[model samples]
Target: MATCTVALTAIDSSSRQSLEYSSANQSPESDDEAPRMSLLRKLAVIIQLSGVNFASSAVNGLVVVGLPTITADLKLDPSLAFWPTSVSSLANASTILLAGSVADSIGPRPVNIAGGVVTGAFILAAGACKTGPQLIVMRALQGIGYAMHLVSSVAIVTHTLPRGRPRNFAFSCLGLSQPLGFSFGLVLGGILQDLIGWRAAWYIYGGLTLALSVVAAWALPNFQNEGTFKGTMRNLKVRVDWVGALLASIFMTLLSYLFAIRDPKSIVFICLIAMSLPLFVGWVHRQVKLGKPALIPNALWKDTAFSSICGTVALSFGVTTCMELFASLFFQEVQHLSPLQTGLRIMPSLLVGVALNVTTGLFVHRVPALWIVTVSSIICSVAPLLMAVIKVQSPYWANAFIAQVLAPMSTDVLFTVGLIIISDNFPDNTQALAGAVFNTASQLGQALTLGIMQIVSTLVTKDYSDKILPMARLEGLRASFWTMFGFMMLCTLWGAIGLRNTGRVGLKRD
Candidate 1:
């Protein structure tokens, strides 16, 4: 198998000959230089990365929407079934900073290739598991692989492409690819699970990932050697606050655990929160006072563009994810829809998500980032507010469906905008940091929203029917929509007041 992998890699590399010229000024204008297919190579890179996105999305959609199915099939407890995704989240969050450092020290090419290999391997392994514990362990490893792949891919995209409208467009296009994967996963995974089985979906995704890994080895540009050991050693000499990393991880883990347990008023959970909260806060302050390169760089956090983008990502993403997951529940459990039926039911919003993703990428160069974000946030909030007002007798084609369509447009539009802003703001040296932070915010925000919505939904349904009737479910669903409404409104306010207005095109380096 290993030999086969290497042979495949070799074949891929031979198909696409890339010429790396030394100087920054080197261009394709010269006749003698092995004719640089920069455009072709960039296209190849985007296509390759889009495959990675598809694989991850396929698996995640299975995990998220297939939760009810997986739990029932495996005979696992409903609550514990969250372990696969929770483990994935924990591992992803833990590995990103370390991977960022590694990517910066070593060129992104090797790290990216390594991640592709591991991601394919682990995703395949996940399919072979029979029990929840085994599944969680494999998923966690996959998370590590994902962090490496994501950081490496984004670093390559941001650094390899010159910083300008082209780079901004690439970032937006990549963000757009996210929804393509997600939408495909939802519709396709549901079809596969019904026609064959849920486990088959995993195996199929694994095959796709393995095939894409080979393409990556061939078409993606090799990591440009940005100089030697001396450059890396200089960065290593700068202090890395290991203590800060540990503290932050501890806080993140504990907070997530607390949220998972959904015991907001529990003394034990409250005490853990109380103790960890202050320690995490104090540690961040100490890192700043000592001028150390903490788990999160103080300088990066202080950048208005970076911070604004992060906030927008957190809230906007939180709403989209929460709405999607619970909407599945609303359709499946409340309205008694089939899994395929539920997937079809949500098509309005999901389809709109894909459309906006593509449109935003195409026009991002001509629009202001701030205005795009603000308008999207407002649209997102209004979509949910419209849903919140839906009556039990309301038809899908009425305000509910219209709101759903409008809802995801804003969510996807802001996603592209946020990615463009962050990619443009960070230095080439910090490409991994930029990717890690953006993904981290998006992922954590999703996780946080799921947990919070669980609590709010439970509260609203506490006194309701035993079978979770549609009327009761609708009430609980409204509460969740209100939560999303609040989040998107906040995103709008922050984007308006806090973000530094920048061109729709990416910023040029000083």
Candidate 2:
């Protein structure tokens, strides 16, 4: 009862706090500068923004599909094999807050362009690497660049474009581009692995992304006026909440590292990771009391809708990421499929994602967010459930294909809706931080699930010592699949209660 009262109080305060801009449809003509944005220019800007997502996400896909080939050629240590796949996410999770905070203060244009350049250069460097460690380092560096691009891209969309059809379609495209790029990577990685090399894939990705960055220069609007370099630096020093930012980053970075390494022996990492939360809480309390800017306003979580969306996004995205990785692993290891075959099998999810994103964009304003999120959560739960009970000899069409289609249902929907809700919860001016906070939740979920799933798989697989290696691996995957199922169900239940009052978002406004 006490907690509920506090939550309600926070909700009331937050209602007064956040201006619900993203869900209310203000047409493109609302802003004077918006009228001058020609259709061709709009399309170009959309491509430039969404293109970055596609390219960065493709790196993750390529890593997953091409891991065996990459490891073998680069002579990656057996122990560090997964690092290449996980490190990019790790890096992204660690620094996203800082990137968002900086972008919000200085302007997103510089940050976005710099990120693109860094991402392309690092990817190219990754391609040129001969050592596994070098590749991992480059991937980590590129992830930071991706953090810059990802956060800024969202700010650019939310701030520059008005709140109606143009913005809706753009957000939808942003959601679509991620899975689309991942699917593209899976197919492209396999083809390159078989014919040329994984290096060639990186070269292609890097070059194209660099080209997109160049286009983005002229394409993206100056929604937030740019400050001089000296002025920007000074603003960052004074306006930014450095203590809150530091506490948040340390917590995220340390916890993620512990999760990734999973060293039961590292008591120190465990203790520090545990300590970060309270310190962050203290910082938040200070910010709210002092009436200063916070990295993530402490009051935001008091709203049932925002909190629920954050939880759902973390779990849903984590599961989606896990499904993609584990599904590929299942196809290859349990069924003994080839890399190309594994990539082909996962293509169904991408098609579903594209379709859902488009549909959600067009009709989201007319539908209740509660129904959209909860129903999709129920449907996507089946994807992991299929894998949890599947037989080795099961036909791909009978089981895997359906799972693929179901896997993306909730997440793709949530990507657009969650962004809407998140954008709604934050002030319009702090779009970059909102993007960072949203992405941080997403990346945090990925980090948590990846770490936890890997742990589950490892422990479960170890118990099946009497079984053959393939059988043991299958058992591990099943355990993780069950874990994924639980996550989706929780997401569904959370939404059912939390979003009961969240009606028809994205409605047209003046």
RMSD of each: 6.4, 7.5
If scored against the real structure, what TM-score would every candidate get?
0.84, 0.93
Question: What is the C-alpha lDDT profile of model 2 across 389-477, one tens digit per residue?
Answer: 99899998888899999999999999888888887777666788888888988988988888889889988999997899999999999
| Candidate 1 global lDDT | 0.69
Residue-pair clashes per candidate: 0, 0
| Candidate 2 overall lDDT versus native | 0.84
For residue 119, give model 1's deviation from the true position in Å.
2.8
The parts of candidate 2 lying over 4 Å away from their true place are: 1-30
Q: Report the C-alpha displacement of residue 267, candidate 1, in angstroms.
A: 5.4
> Best-fitting candidate, measured by TM-score?
2
User: How far is 452's C-alpha from truth in model 1 (Å)?
Assistant: 0.6
For model 1, residues 13-98, the per-residue Cα lDDT tens digits are 42232332333432222112113434455566777776787687668777766777877776776667567656676677666666
